[model samples]
Target chain A: MKVKVPKTLLTEHVALLERVIPTRSSNPLFTYLGLALTPDALVLFGTNGEVDLEVRLELPTEGEGRFLVPAQPFFQLVKSLPGDQVELGFGAELSLSSGSFSTRLSLAPDEGYPELFFPSLEGPAEPYPLQTLLPVEELLKALSHVRYAASNEEYRAIFRGVQLEFSEGGLRSVASDGYRLALYRLAKPQPFAKKVVVPARSVDEMVRVLKGMGEGEVALALGPGVLGLATSGSQGAAATGKGQLRMAVRLMEGEFPDYERVIPKEFPLKAAFDVEAFREALRRVSVLSDRQNHRVDLLFEERRVLLSAEGDYGKGQEEVPVRLEGLPLAVAYNARYLLEALSPLSGQAVLLLSGPTSPSLVRPGEAAEGYQAVVVPLRV
Target chain B: MKVKVPKTLLTEHVALLERVIPTRSSNPLFTYLGLALTPDALVLFGTNGEVDLEVRLELPTEGEGRFLVPAQPFFQLVKSLPGDQVELGFGAELSLSSGSFSTRLSLAPDEGYPELFFPSLEGPAEPYPLQTLLPVEELLKALSHVRYAASNEEYRAIFRGVQLEFSEGGLRSVASDGYRLALYRLAKPQPFAKKVVVPARSVDEMVRVLKGMGEGEVALALGPGVLGLATSGSQGAAATGKGQLRMAVRLMEGEFPDYERVIPKEFPLKAAFDVEAFREALRRVSVLSDRQNHRVDLLFEERRVLLSAEGDYGKGQEEVPVRLEGLPLAVAYNARYLLEALSPLSGQAVLLLSGPTSPSLVRPGEAAEGYQAVVVPLRV
Candidate 1:
């Protein structure tokens, strides 16, 4: 196989490679990226099995055959080369040549390369436009916060993945690390869907790749042990290149817990205030919280909300005026989760969907667009 | 204590506090930052006993007074408030008021705060201008690479400190963590000086603060358990604030190891090339260097060099042309240290300061300005 591709496009594959691929994989086979240099396109993939990145580029392909170089050299060659076209050749000897420099790299046997999966969107596949998949920015924001709540340890295999439930009203994503749980629900939803626990790493990589593509319709296909994402029409104007690309990754199999009961939907006492204002306030409050401390309790009244943290020395309380609903109530929460929920949101007002001595959901006004939830009341 | 100061200055103090104060100190006493809010100044100190930060802000004294508050709250409070002049009034209770926000923070007994030994940079203190101090940027670059080689764990208390030696010729800084050693020397000397082990933390913090400021005389004072750095003139014309202010901190005590013997003067082979060109090549080569693998084994021949790394499957190598100095020789090294030494200078050529084995010094051509050294050779 031989192909000449634009250096910039090839570099994009390198950029995504580092983000999706784990620096150290216990299995040596997993460390190698799958590089398929076709006649019309050069497709690059990097994954540790769980989180994979597949970036496709229509290299003017110049009709080359196919070859797969080891991840490191392939990435390094593309990254170091000058702008213009990078000529890649495969066969008896794999070679990446550009400008005055042409280096031949050793290739691994393609027989052991892990096969990526993409659920066929043909039969029984729900059809949804790119826009309908979910706004890239909003999804990125929700995933960032919820992903943090996933257990990074090997204590509970299932807890490591974030659970996502999609129904008619919207999509709810939940993650728990035993100690604390974070929930985020997008108010807008597709016609109908179910739930699944996606490996946290894969979702993060998918979000990072999609975020760079601007506003575009990303077709998503969900299935057992596998998932697929394909992009077509963009949000604003036509983005450069074909934009029709697919990334297929394997999913972790486990029993995701029922997180619905974890979030208290009926917040007895509600409060409304500027989202940024509250976010900044919570950030300040967090600084004073004990490094070992986890939640900040919210004491809500008719027209004021008091955020407080009790530590060894004393209690730290800050009150901000806010119009509330129902009787006065106080609910505790992890200040970090609260701050995370507020960070991505942008709105004039934030509505605290709370409950007495129960978990509270923090959602910004419609203008904020994004959604985030923090389960509180860990107890004093 | 009662006084009003600019928020910007207070914010700067907080920035310094965030780094100097460790989140948890072995001794609880070290956890509290000694705040001597005298009528004349606000002196704040945070130390892990190993590395300490004592910063004094001269607040115009109007009414005579004093107080001490918890460091974290004080930093958070001042940061949360708005406006320039922050009214800080205290007697039995400490109240810091700004704009419409008012926070009354409780203070710890001033007696509980430890008294820091503020060194006398006063008596007959000698001043070393830029001409003698070596380019601050050179010192910084050298420190950046060498500090990483220092042991993070203080198994050898003195080894954790960066040993900086001086003589009539110039200054050389050395740091090693048993596995690797990095030595950097300047081309020329500035007037007079002695040697001392400046704690890596102190050197790092000083470099960070120094980067913000310019070319001026940095008065040096080396005392028992102290190394004072006071840059008197404007860091540069583009510098900010009253650049005349001097910042000094104490250093660690002890005679550093004799490291000059570590750099061998003679080698069987040597090759010279452009510093940047070699650095980039080494960087690409480093993508495969792991603790388990000696990334590259370099061979120097007639005006040419070959760098090869043998992986689990096969071997890969790159040949670069250079200026040869001795007989052809081959040796292996951890590619990282070699890449680091190849950085930090401006010139078209680099002189390979070599030894018998892979242990060699990569001196970027500006030897008259600055120089760097690295010791390598383990498994090839």
Candidate 2:
């Protein structure tokens, strides 16, 4: 296989592939990225058993063949080249030459390269059951707000994914790690019949890719065991003729817990406070919180809330003013969980509590229509 | 002891003390910072056996006493306070209160606190043998260029410190760890009896302090076993009536090797190249270098140099143009050592090579009068 491509274009695609490729795996082939060249374009593929990413480049090429090379070293070498054009030739080895320097790198056999099967959008044999279109920026923003709540514990496979449910009202994304839960709702909804649980790792990668592309439309398709996301090679006006990029991740096969019942229905004790000010006060007082549990107490009064923490080392307390309309109450919680729950919020935030042991709900103060986060209280 | 001080001022001084205190130590007192309040000033002290730092704040006080508090927790509490003025009271426990927030932290006995002995700057009781005044910025810049060459190996005490030699000609700082040697010269020098070896850890703290101040003058006094650095507390125009800050580090007791012989005296092959370009090329090619050794080969021709590194994983090569004035040569060296030695250089860099096995000298191409770095080549 022989191909000539622009350095910048090749570098960008290789960087994307590197993100999906695992640094080490049981199968050595999983650490290598496959490159297939045709007369019309060059295709790059990277996978780590669970997720597969394919990027197509429309640059002109000669001769048709395939090769597998170590992703990290190959990417590093290509990125380091100083010339605008790079010439690549693949045989028993891969040769990359640019300007006055050339390097011949050893390649692994391509026989073991994993086969990537992208679900078809429309086909007679087998078609994806669900297909939807959404704005990349908005979807990514909503995912970022809830992804942190997903559990990192491997024992519970269902809690390790973000649940995406589409209905007549809107498209809702929900994630819970048992201790805390976050829910974000977007108004646009498609005619999807089933819910898709995207692995937390894939959600992170999606955010990274969409964030880099700025504003674009993503075509999403979900089948029985796999989910696919594709972008039609257009980033503003400069990326017109580039080939499309596709990504697929295996969906988790488990039943997600019923989170609707967990969210409190009524919040008798409610208080509204400046988001930034409350966050700052939590950060300061939490410094002295118990290292093991990170517990900080919140004492709500008439028009103010006192945040305090005590441990073997010392004790810290700070008072922040708030607009209140409820009876006084005091509750303790893991400061880290509260901080992470409040980080994605902006402007003023409202806190709703029913009792000391009951779960507390937090939402954006001015508008309570879109997002909500619920955190369990810890015993002091 | 009771004192009222501005939160920002006290926080800044405590930060300086925290840098010198060890996180954990065999002697528990080394983990605590000592605070002594007199009618005139409040003095903060922290020591880790090897280095001692004391900062004096001339704030209004009511009583005279001394106490020791854990460095990290105390600093965290003070930094988290919300009000401008903090009232501190010392008894069986240390109490820090501001506004409506207060914290009582358990304190260690002050009797175990390490005693700090300041070198006499004036008076006949015991005069410092060497005393000099220099701009803090200049001193820090020179130290930054050579400190990386100091060895972290505890067995070789001599190589773990930067040798400071003062004479009528200039103040020279030299550090070597067998593989490389760096020498920096400052023209403004004062009369001194002998050379002092300042530990690398102390040099790092000195740089941090000087860089934080931005611009100031440091009064340096060196005695037989200790070195004292004092700076008048003046930051811009707002800092007035602030007491001076003093820091002392115990000098390493050992015979330093003569590094003068390590620098190559004459070179048959010399080349000049753009510093930034060479650095970038090294960074790129070195990515594929061997994991253990990180060896990169430099092939110098008439007007260009080819940098290449090959490992079990892959190979990378890049060519950077340079101005050559001598015969062609090929040399291999650890990429990390070379990168660090060249980082402190600016603009054009001149490389003087004696042979493939001999030491190579690198200096600023425009003028080779102030600084020189010599690195020994490794077998490719």
Candidate 3:
């Protein structure tokens, strides 16, 4: 079998597959990427047992063939080739030729390659509404805001995924690690009403693909055990295009914990301060905090907030003015957790507190409709 | 004791001292930075067992006092302070106060600090001319060109230092690790004729300080066992300035190996190629080379060079045009060594090969006056 494709398009397709391929595996066949050539198009598949990605490029071919090639070296070689027409020939071995460069690659046994099945979007036996169109930018923004809060602990498999809840009004993305929680709400409602928990690793791969896409719409489909996302040139012509990229990830098997109870509803003290100024103060004072606990004390007064940290080596303190209402309070928090939560906010931030042992809430000062972060305070 | 100094100047002095202080040491006193305050100026000192550094800042004080503070926390705290005047107070403990912040730091025992001695430039029994003035930019440029070639092997102590040879014609800096060598020559001659071996760590610290200096002159002083470098304002006002910064590094005790015999005097094959193009080809081909040997074969023919690498996983090949002369030859080299040697060259590069087994030399295409790099080829 033989095929001819533009060098630039081939390079782009290989780069997308490289992100999903596993670098090392006990089974030798798992380390190779599978390529199937048909009469109309060439399909590339890569999987790490949990998440699988398939990309299709429109190319005119002569015959049907299937082969597996080592992921690392082949990806690197194609990236270095010049932007011209590239010819590929396959038999017992694979040969790639471009310009004055030609090399032969030994192929892995095709018998050990796993069979891949993509979930169908439209079928008579389908139970759920599997097709929904979403704006690409809004989906990326919602993931970035809540991905960091997902837990990495393997014991509790439920917290290792981010929950996507769809309602009549909007879509809510929530993540929690028992110590902190982040909630992001997007106000673009769709006709489908369902809930799904996507694994953290799959969310990361989705973000990488979405960032490179042009201004368009992404089509999402959910089946029994898998979730698929596909993107093309534009919204109207998504089904028929020159080429398309699709990713299917296995959904988590457990139920996520209830996070609404974690957020404190009643607050006796509220303080509004500049986000930049508060972040800078925490950065300076935390330099002297204990390395293990990273505890920093915050003392709220009538119109000011004092931050201090004391360690075996020395002590540090800083003062920043704030607009305070209700009763004044004092609390201790891990400096690292606070820094991560405040880094994404802009302009001003409002902090709500109930008591020394209660969880604290952080939100944007002017708008509290879309996003919120809750952090558990440490004992002073 | 109490004194006032500008925050910017104090931070600069501490930054210089922090480079020489060891974070962990068996002797507890080695982890502290000593500050000795006199009527006219303040002196700061830090040392490991192998190297020592001292800096002076002119400030008015009432009496004399000596104290030692933890190096890490103190340096970090001072860097975070606002750019304003800071006050220092010393009693049983050290106190630092700035704006609305203040902290107390317990001091290490003064008796545990080591005694320091500085070599004099105007001594009566001096044998050689001790002082030579040079531009800061020239000194920094010379150090950056040849520092990467220094060896870090502990068994061969002589190979770990950079040899500084000063003569009537010029100053030469040379470093070698048995496999590769780098030579950098500065054409400004002085009246002093001396040979010294400075440790690699000291050379790195000197580069850091010289990069931070303004447009000024640095005065170098040599004595029995130490090398001193001092810099102030412009050359005209160097002698009568408010304060001056000085650094003294202990000279290495071992004799350096002779490096002149390693440079080849004759070559049978000469190839001139564009540096940028050659570097890009090597980078791409090396991705498929063996991880342990990193061997890449270069085949030199009529007017071109073919570079190729074969590994267990795959194979890569690239062809680059070059101007060749003399006998045709083929040689194999470690890709990492060739990349490092060619990265610093600006224009075209000339490769001079003596034979398949002998070392090859790389120099600028236009001139061979100031710099050269020598690399040994691997057996394929």
Candidate 4:
């Protein structure tokens, strides 16, 4: 179909498609990006068996043509050509001629492209303000950190997935691989109360879409058996499964244990210090930490807090002066998790609330923004 | 031995070591970077089973201490730490203490460090005029044009490497992977006669050292079995094989095939145009190339270079005006190779010298700067 679309818009969509498109695969049909020319818009979908990516761009179309250009050449050509206007002449062979660069590239068969449809999710689609939509970037950053810690070889569902819990206080994310647990939470809007476990694959795609989301609020929809989340943007506006533009995420059907109970609520000992100071100290100490060692000992004494992690290799210790409350306590917790959780803390002051040899609640103080961590004690 | 050394220099050595060091393999010594400290110098050696690297710096020491540091934590900790001069305290723990950052890393047993004896080569240790040295940056820039053409997985050893042939004319470099070849030469060089196949890996490392070598010349020590080429700066110098202050290289022993046989010395038909103009056209036309069949059929007529690569997926073609000499010729060649080979050409005019269905010779006719390619004609 003959259409006139904004060059930047088309280029941006194509750029994102290029990132998600499968390159080295036996199925050339999978490489085809489907462009459906509608009366007032153009719908582009790039799917490679496992994931379906749909982006709907507003355009002026006089006639209709389905352009299934071979993904590789088209991306390469568009990237190489410096142009504001690209004339796409679709016949038996799709020819995209760029006026600016004086270049023309032909594409593969459009008909050979497999039909991609959004799976029929049982629940109704709910829209979320792209911003409010589960700390899009924040949650993604947290997931990527500890996702490395999750066990990959095991076929057990929860072991390879990240647990997302939205409760009375805010949102919490936890990932573990039996030996250690990385728990991260951000205290924000309080009304919601729900929990869902998302596989790494889903989290990856979510991270992909979240890349474009800015200050706008992202809407989230949690279904009975599935999870549907959409952000307001060109990416979020993509026409996905079936005819919908929202991404349909299949939530893991597995039991996520009570990570909360593992977090000790009452501590006879407590230590308060600068979050930045502690994070910096940990960064220094972590350098000497044994990768095989499970923990970094946090010793609380009068007017001082010591963070140390070392083993047969060597020892790294950082002592930061702090106001000690409750009682003196020395507990060992995973340094990796402490670093992961401390990273998201926005300000300087941090409250290291301990439950005497129990799981420690490392929460960002009132002046500090967001973020908290709960670490199960490690016997050094 | 305790002395404060610039962290950046130590970090730089560690960075290089990390890339070359391989863990968990035979030749366990390859994973350890030998640290030899005298009152005058601190020399570090990093070696993989395939490649070895040695760098030296100045640090005060009470006496000579030679040991190999386990590269993993040593490199990792060095990278993470931020400081100018870090106090190096090697005692019972061998700890590197900096403020809050302290790590006592394990050292690999020091039994197998290659005995590093400074090489006193046959070549005039009398330095080549610094101005006479190959402008490393220039050579590196030129090498990149053909480096990609070298086959990564070499079924045939020479084919997998870059051929550096030096005759009376100049330095001609040719790299290919059967499907295509990229041939280029620097016409302006002092008289030299010798031929060698330099490993692409060696070339890559040489390029890294050459990046800052502006007017500084590379000292050539043509050894009995190797090409020992070294570059020096105010700080130090490095090369291919095991050497002290000077870099040494081992030349390939096998004979490289006669590349001249495939090159077209005489072309009855020819086309000439601006080098960059032709390069841009090739790049644009290449976007239409199908991986299944990698060819761009050029139909040269009266005054235009009509490039076409058509197959099942699609067709890509571009036509640009050019100056031609002799009879008209039509031939097809790998578009990717043509684009790559032509990309480095910077002259105002490009000469496409062709014969009766022979491989086309692409060179800059009026342009004096060197680089020429003999593309084997493809049957359309």
Q: Give each model's whole-structure lDDT.
A: 0.62, 0.82, 0.78, 0.62
Alpha carbon lDDT at B55, candidate 1: 55
* lDDT tens digits, residue span A1-380, model 2: 78887887888778878888988999879999889997777888989888888877876678898888888788777777878888999888888887766777888888867788664434212445677777887788678999999999988779999998877777889999888999998888666556779899989987876665557777778777887877776432114535557888888886577878888988779989999889888987887789999999999999899999988777878889998887899999999999988888888998898778999988888664578899989974
Q: Mind giving the per-residue lDDT tens digits that candidate 3 earns over A253-326?
A: 76676778888999899999999888878887887788889999999998899999988877778888899988
User: Per-residue lDDT of B1-380 in model 1, one digit per residue for the tens?
Assistant: 57676777667655766676666767666656565565556655676665555555665645654455666666666677645667777666566666544555666675655554433334333331212344556667657757777767768787777887777877777887665677776656646567677777777887775664455444445556565554443322112333232344565677666666776677555566876666665555544444465467677788677766655434445566788877777777777656545545545555454654545666655455455566567543
Q: Residue B260 in model 3: shift from native, Å?
A: 3.6
lDDT tens digits, residues B191-232, model 3? 588888788888898888777665667777677767777776
Ranking of all predicted structures according to DockQ, beginning with the best and ending with the worst? 2, 3, 4, 1
TM-score of chain B of each: 0.79, 0.91, 0.86, 0.82
Using Cα atoms with residue i matched to residue i, what is each candidate's TM-score against the true structure?
Answer: 0.79, 0.88, 0.84, 0.83
Candidate 4 TM-score, true structure as reference = 0.83
Clashing pairs counted in every model: 10, 0, 0, 23
Q: What tier of docking accuracy does candidate 1 attain?
A: acceptable
**What order do candidates take by TM-score, descending?**
2, 3, 4, 1
lDDT of 1: 0.62
The per-residue C-alpha lDDT of model 3 at residue A207 equals: 87
Better of 1 and 3 by TM-score: 3
- Score candidate 2 by DockQ: 0.51
Report lDDT (Cα) of residue A166, candidate 3.
76
Error of 1 at A319 (Å): 4.8
